[model samples]
Target: MSVVIEQPKSPRSRKAANWEKYGWMYMRASGAILLILIFGHLYVNLFVGQGIKGIDFAFVAGKWANPFWKVWDGLMLWLALIHGTNGMRTIANDYAERPMVRKVLNYTLWIVCAALIILGTLVITTFDPCIDPNASTYLPGVCAVK
Candidate 1:
């Protein structure tokens, strides 16, 4: 007599390049990058120059004024946001059993992530130093001087 065997269910089709595999790789990569970026940010903000006291609106404005910082912040923004979102997506997929509910939640997550990323990039890149120069309270010193 021949014995019968059963195959376990897969979340995805066998023929496809697995998104979960890519997501796992991304988690590792982004996590490594995040550690470096986060530590650099902490060091600069908490240990360099005047430290915490130096971190006012002017400080942020000055940092954003530089292309280097702009790029750094943009990278941090995108990587961290996507990493966090993907992590949550993993959790949601694991817990949410209903197909319709999972689909809705996942859709919401992507929409929110996209919106935030776009808005953050726009804010970082297009921020003006003279939007309201005379409004010193709202303006950083750099902006107020303009």
Candidate 2:
């Protein structure tokens, strides 16, 4: 008795899209940025002033008041989301065996990731802590308009 194993074709031979190369580059770029953004976020949130104890609704409102922190948070949000999403895509490609299953899972993954990213970015950028504070339980007393 004998058995045979078929090897996958080279990407060049199959003329597959260059998505892998782009994906590799994205990983490296996102990883370096993630390191900076992650550390900076931690430094401010855990080391500034009263440290973690200072984190409250007021603290967040103050932070968002500054354009700098807004951009910082926005960058962190985009970078982390793209990095995580790409990583998950790699995992899905590796684990999903059936063509149909892989396609379905990847489609779902991208749709959900995109939706969350858009919604989160919108919320962060447009957030107004002082908007009808009395109407919302999430608002702090300090944010109520006098």
Q: What is the TM-score of each candidate against the true structure?
A: 0.80, 0.79
lDDT of 2 by residue, 32-102 (tens): 98899899899999998999999987788878878998888888888888888888878877777777787
* Backbone collisions counted per model: 0, 0
* Tens digits of per-residue lDDT for model 1, 1-146: 22221222335566776676678889999999999998999999999999998997778887887889898889999999999998888777777777777778889998999999999999998987667646556664455433
Best by TM-score: 1
Clashing pairs in 2: none
lDDT of 1: 0.81
Looking at candidate 1, the ten consecutive residues that score lowest on lDDT are 1-10
Model 2 residue 124 distance off true place after TM-score fit, in angstroms: 1.3
Q: Indicate which candidate wins on lDDT.
A: 1
